[model samples]
Target chain A: MKSVYIVDDSIISPLGFSVEENLQNLKNNTTGIVEVKDTSIHTDSFYGGLIDEKRLTDAWDALSEIASYTKLEKMMLLAMQRLLDKNPQLDITRCGVLISTTKGNIDQLKENNTDRAYLDTLASAIQQFYKLGNSPTIISNACISGGLAIAIAKRMIQAGHYEDVIVVGGDLLSEFTLSGFFSFQAVSPKPCKPFSKNRTGISLGEAAAATWISGSIKNTNISEVVEVVGEASANDANHISGPSRTGEGLYLSIQRALDEAKVSASDIDYISAHGTATPFNDEMESIAFSRSGLEDIPVNSLKGYYGHTLGASALLETIIAKHHLLANEVVCSLGFDELGVSYPIDVIKKNKAIAMQHVLKTASGFGGCNVALVLKKVSI
Target chain B: MMVEDYKITSFCSIKDNKVIVDNKVLYVHEEQGTVKEFTKAIYKSLGIKYPKFYKMDTLCKLGFLATEALLRNAEKPDNQTALVLSNRSSSLATDRIHQESIANKEDYFPSPAVFVYTLPNIVLGEISIRHQFKGENAFFVSEQFDAKLLTDYSRLLLDTNKASNVICGWVNLDSNKYDVFLAIISRKGNTILTEEQLNKLYHT
Candidate 1:
C-alpha cells in the first residue's frame, strides 16, 4: 500500500546524448529519425534513432579498466551517472537494479564461434564497475521490457527489501535486429508515422535510459514528482508475433492497473502510447485504447522523436513523459496527422499545455506480452 | 507472497508443424533435422496446445505455456497482478537463426515468419492475450537459477501495492533445451508462500 515515486531519470538517444538535449528536441518537435545510407540493409531509405559513439568516450573514465565492456555498457553507465548527479544522496546498495534490454551483445553472437560467454562477462563487468554485484537484475522481455523493469523495481521496493530501485533500459541497433525487423516486413522504409493513414512500419532505434524510484522523498530539487501507482501484465494467446484483434491482453492489463491504482478509466488525463508505427501495432493500440474507454484521452508516440528504441522505448518514453509532466506540457504525437485507425480518439498534433495529474504509459510486444503503468503527479 | 491457488491451463508445443506433449511423440517417424529440431521438440512437448503454438519459437512457446498454466490455476485476480520473469539468454537463439538467414550467401532471404521470434517477452504478450490478466509485467535474465531474486522482486511489487497479485517465474529456451515454471503470488495475507517454500516447490 506504499507508493513508489520517480526521483530522477536520464536518456541517451538519437535526439541528443543527454536528457536535457532530448527534452529540448522533444519540446521543439525535432525528430531524430532519418534516412540511412548503409548498404547492408535492403531498403535504400530507412530511419533510425542512433546514438553518437564519439560522445560516449566521456563515460570511459567510469569504467574500471574492464576489457569486456562494450559501447552499450558505457551508454548505460553514462545515463546512470547523470541520474546520480541529479540525485547524489541515493543509496546504490539499498536500491534494486532492474535492467531492460532485448539483445545483449547479440552482434557478438552473430560472429561465428562465440559462445554464451558474453552474458556472464558483461554481467560481471557491470557488477564490478558499479560495485552493484548483489543488487543488479536484468529484464529482457522484448519491447515491453522497459516498462516491466520499472514494474519489477517497484515490486521489490514495496516488498520492504529495498527503499530505492534503479531501473535501466537500453539496446543497440545492429545487423542482428535490422535483419530481423526487415524479415518480418515490420521495418518502415522512411521515418515512421504513428497512427497515420500511410503509416509504414517501425523505424529501428538504439538508446539508453535510467531512472530512480523509491517511496522515500530524497531530492527536493525535482520539479514534478510522479508516483507509479499501478502496474499489470497479460498474455495474448492469439499469436506469437501478431497481436489479438481484440487486444484482449492490453485491455486486461490496463483494467488490472486501474483496479490496483483505485482509479477509473475516465480519471486518466493522458496516455503515453506504445505506438510503434507498425500497421498492426498502431491499429491494435488504438483499438485497445478505445475498448478500455480511453478514447477521449490524448495519445502520442515518442517513436518519431527517438525511433523504436526497443528495450529503451518504455523507459525512454516514461522519462519523456516525466519531463512533460514536470513542464506541464504534453508533446504532440510528432508523425501523426490523422486518425488513421477506425477507433475514435484524439491524437495530439502539437505541443499542448494541459494540467495532467495522472498519465498511463502502455506497451505490448511479440510474445503477446502487454504492460501498463499508471503514474500520478505527486504534490510534494 | 502466498499462492492461494494456481493451475496450468492450456499447454502445447509445435515442432515440424506437429504438436507433441508428455505422452505424444509427433516426430518419431521423421528422418531427422538436427540438435536444434530435438530442442524444438522438447519445447513443443512442454506446451499445452499444439496448433496455436506452432508459430512460436522456443522462448515464445515456453512463456506461452508457462503463463497459460499459471492463469489456468489462479482465478483472474480482482486487481492487477505483477509479472516478474527471468531467462538466461533472452532472444539470442532466434536472433542467431535470423542473423544466419541474412548473413549467409546461400540463405540470403529473410523470413518475417522466423524474424518475429527475436523478442524475449513475446511470451508475455501471448499470456496477456489468453488470460486478460494485465497488471505489471517484466522479464529478467540471470546467469543461473536464483529464486531469492524472484521472491525479492515479487515482494517489491506486493509491498508497493503496484500489484495485488504477482505472477513471477523463469522461462528459458535455447538451441539445446528449455525449462519453464511460473507462479502467481498475492500481496494479501491469505494463501501466501515464503521464498523458501516457493523455492522448494520449484527445485524439488
Candidate 2:
C-alpha cells in the first residue's frame, strides 16, 4: 500500500487565511470565536467564529475574478487556490477532489429556487472552477465528513485510483444550522469550553480547510511530511442524535485505527479529540479514551478557538495537529479549567513544548458516526 | 494491489411504487400517491413492527425499508457490516422542511426531530440501530449514482478486513420523487459483485 502524505494545506477562517497565520494565532492562544449578533442567522446573540466579511471580500476581490460566487464557494475556492499555489507542480489531471460539507449552499434555501442548495452543485462549481480531472466526491456524513474525507483519500490513493487527492471541508453558519442547533438546545451561550467542568454546549463556527494528500511526498519546500498511517470509522448503532454512554462506537473506531496502523494505544503521543463540550459528548469521549487505554495522552479540543465548524472541524483540527507535530509543541485545550468528564484522561490545559511524533485525531458526529485517524511525522 | 472477489448476497430496490427484492417484485402499489403514501404502503406490506419507521423522513424510510427487505430472509449479518450509501439530493427533502420551520421569524419553530434528519447519514444510523450493526459506515453525495466509487470503496473495506459485510448503494429523495437501491455484499454469494454488476442492478 502507498503511504499517504499531506503535502500541502490551507485554512480560511476568522483567525486568518493561511496555515501560517492560523498557527501563529494558536501559538498566541488567540481565539476566533466571538459574540455573534446577526439577526439574519439567529434572533438572539450567540457565540460563533465567523470570518470577517469585509476581509473575505477584499481577499476575493484581489483574485480579480469576474464570476459571482456564494460565501461558501469563495471560502472553498480561496482555500484550495492557496494550497494549489503552494504546490504549483501538481498535475490537475491526475488529482481527485473530495468535498466534505454538511450543508453547502444551505443558506440559499430561502430563495424560491434552491438549485444551488444541492451538495453536488457545490462540488460541481468547484470542479468547474479548477477544471479538475474528475467530479468531486461529496462526503456529507455530518461532522465526521472532514476527517473521513482524509481517510477515504488515503484509501483511494492506496488502491491506485489516484496519485493525489485534494480534500476540502467547509460549512457556513446560517439560520438553517443555527436554528437547528438552537432547537436541540445544544448551542452554548458563551465561548465553548471543551472538557471543562463549566462547559455548557457547542459554539457554532464557519471555516474552509483544505489539504493535499498524495501517495508520494511533494512540495519539498516543507521541512517535514505528515503521513496518514491508519484511519477507520464506526457507527455507534445506538442513537442518531445522541452519543452512546458507553462510547462503544468510538472505542471500536480507535481500536480498529490502532490495529491498522500496527501501533499500540501507548504509542500515541497526543490526541486531538472531538470535544464538542456538550456534557454528553465530552463524557463519551472520555469514556472512549479510557477504554482505549489512552487516558494518559494529552488531548486538546480546538473548538474553543474555531468553535464547531461541522464538516470543517476535523480537517481544520488535523491541519493544526500537523503544525503541532512540526513544532513539537502541543497547544492548550482552550477554555478548560477543571476536569469535566468522569474518566481521567489528560486534557491539556496549557500550551507546552513536548516531543511528539504520533497524534491521534478522532471525531464523532450525528448519525452515530465516529472516526479515528492516526498521523505520524516523518522527516523529509 | 491484489484484488479480492466478492459477491452480492442480497439486493433490494424501491422505486416507482414497486418493491423488488433480488430481481423479484415483492410489492407494487397500483395507485399513484405521494412518496409518504408509497413508503407507508411498503412498510405495511413488510409487516415489521418498527414504530421508529414512521418518524423518519422520506429518505430514511426509503433506505430503512430497502434494507429490511434486503435482509428479510437472510441470516442476521455480522455486527461489523458497514454501510456505504450515496445520493445526489442528500437530505434536501428534510432540509427543506427544516428550512421552512425557521424561515419565518413569527412561525419559527424548529423541532429537534426534524433537524436531526437534515443530514444524509442519519439514515445509516437508523438502519444501524435497527440491525444492531456497529460497523464502519459512510454516506456520499454525487450528481448521480457512481458505481465505480461505491464498489471501489466497498472493495477496499473488504480487502482490508475493515468490514465483514457491506450494505452499499444509493437512496435519494427529492420533490416527492424517490429511489432506493440497497445490496448486501459479502464473501459468500451466488453472483460476483463488481462495478458493472452494481450498475446493472441499479438500472434494473
Candidate 3:
C-alpha cells in the first residue's frame, strides 16, 4: 500500500556533478565517454567515462574536511549531500539508507591491507558519516544492484519498515574491473554504440547517484512526483557470464513488473534499456522488447553518454528517466547510426518531445540477473 | 496491510567441514584442508552428477551444496521461489584472485572464467540455474547476518504475491573460512520463520 515516490535525487558523473548539468549534457547530445589512456587501469587505451579528478577533489574539498575517505566514498557522499541539501526538512535520523555498489573500496585491495574494502564496512562509513538511524544495507548484485536497491526501498516503505529511505549507488573505474572486462574482451576501444549495427562493447564509467524515496511527498521541491509504480527482478537461470539467447529472464522481469504495475505492455511510453552495446546484450534486449509486445515503443540506452557504470547504471538512468518524464522529452540514444539486432525495436535515434506519462527501466547483468522498474509521473 | 505468517519449510547449513540438514549432520570431513577440498568432498557425498559444480568458485560451491541438501527430499519448488542471500566478504576471495592475475604486467592474463565469479550474487545465479528458479532474487551484504532484514524482505515478497516461496538466509566465504545457512520460507510448514527463530538457527 503506501505509494513510494522518488522525492529528491542527485547525480555525480563525468558529464557533471549535479542532475541539472547531467540533463543539460544529455539534451545537448554531449557524451562523457572518451578515449582513456590510463595505464594504471589497462595496458592499452580504452574508452570510458571517467570523472575529472581535479573537479572531484575541488567538489569534495568544498563539502567536507574528511580527507581519509576513498574516491568512491566521496562520490557517494557528495551525491547524497546534494540530495539532502535540496530537502532541508528531511529528517536524516528517521530514514534508512541502502547502498548499491558492486565493489566497495575494491581498489583498496591493491595494497592488501585495508579492512574498509569490505562492502559492509563501506556502508558503515557512510552510516557513521551521516549518523543515520539504521545500518545501511549493501546491495551488491552485479549491475542490477542499483535498480534492485530502489525496488527493495519500495518494499521496505510499503511494509511500514521506514517512512523514507535513501538509496545511493556508486562504482568506480579501476584496474580490477578494467582488467576483468578486458580479459573478457568486453571493453570497447571507442565510445560505445548501444543498439547500433557497428556497436563494439561497453565503455566502463564511474559515477554515483542518490535518490530519496518517501511514503508521502510533503517536503519535496519538485513540480511532478515520480512514483515507483512496480518493480521486479528475475534470474535467467541460464549462464553466469553470457545472457540468454531467448531473453527469457528479461522477458519475465518485464512481464512481472508490468503486471504488478496494473498496466499492459501498450501502456508503457518509453523504455530505458540496459544496452551495454555488447552484441549479445543488445540483441537479447531487442528480443525481450519484442517478446513483451513493446517493439514499437521508443527505447533509449544512456550508455552512449554515461557508458556502463555497473552498479550505478540502472539508478542513474532511472533518475534521468524521471527528468525525461518531468520535461516531456525522450533523449536520443547516442552513438546509434543504424538499425541493429534481429528484432525491429524502435531505438530512439534523436531527441524528441513527447507526452510521456509512464516509463520502463530495465537492467540485466552478469550472473544472469535482470531487473525492471516501472515509474509514473503524477502532478502534485 | 494484512501480514501473513510464513514458515521455514526446510533448513540446511554448511560450516567447519560439516554438512547439516534440518539439524541433522549429514556429512563431515575429519582432516583439515582447503575450502575447495572440503566443498568437493561434500559434493561427492551428495552423490549428484552436476558437473557445473566444478566450475563455480568456492562461494558458489558452498551455497550449491547447502541448497541441494535443503531440497533433497522436498518437492521441486516452482519458479515462484525467490532467493534472498546475504554475506559479509562479498566474493572478496575471488576478487583477490582476479586482482592477482592482473597485478603484474608480465603475468597479466585475466581469465574470463575466474573473473565471472567476482560478484556475490553469482552464487545466487548458480542456485537459480540448478533449481530452475526463474523468479525475483537479490543478494545483500551486511556485516553480519541480519535476520530481521531478511525476514522483513521475504515477508514483503510473500505478502505482495511477488513470490510463492522464498529461500532466504546467509552464505559467506572468506579466507579459507565459509559459513552457509539457508532455509525455505513459504506459507505452509511446521515452524514459523520469525526473525528470532532464523537467528537462532543461524547461530546453531
Q: Pick the candidate with the highest DockQ.
A: 2
lDDT of 1 by residue, B73-113 (tens): 44566436556677676766677778778786556887887
lDDT value, candidate 1, whole model: 0.73
Backbone clash count, each prediction separately: 55, 0, 0
Model 2 over residues A142-261: C-alpha lDDT tens digits?
Answer: 999999999999988998888899999999988899889989999999999999999999999999989999998754677688999999999999999999999999999999999988
Clashes of 1: 55
Chain A TM-score from candidate 1: 0.95
> TM-scores for chain A, candidates in order?
0.95, 0.98, 0.98
What are the clashing pairs of model 3? none
lDDT of 3 by residue, B3-104 (tens): 768998889999877899888999999989999999999998889799999999999998899999999888788998999999999999999899899889
Q: By DockQ, is 1 or 2 better?
A: 2
lDDT of 1 by residue, A17-130 (tens): 678988889889998877776654444556787676666665555534554567777788777777877777886766677777887666666556356324544565557767
The alpha-carbon interface RMSD of model 1 comes to: 3.2
What TM-score does structure 2 among the candidates reach? 0.98
In model 2, state the lDDT of residue B164: 94
Q: Which stretches of candidate 1 lie over 4 Å from their true place?
A: A40-45, A58-68, A113-121, B1-49, B59-85, B124-137, B153-169, B177-192, B197-204
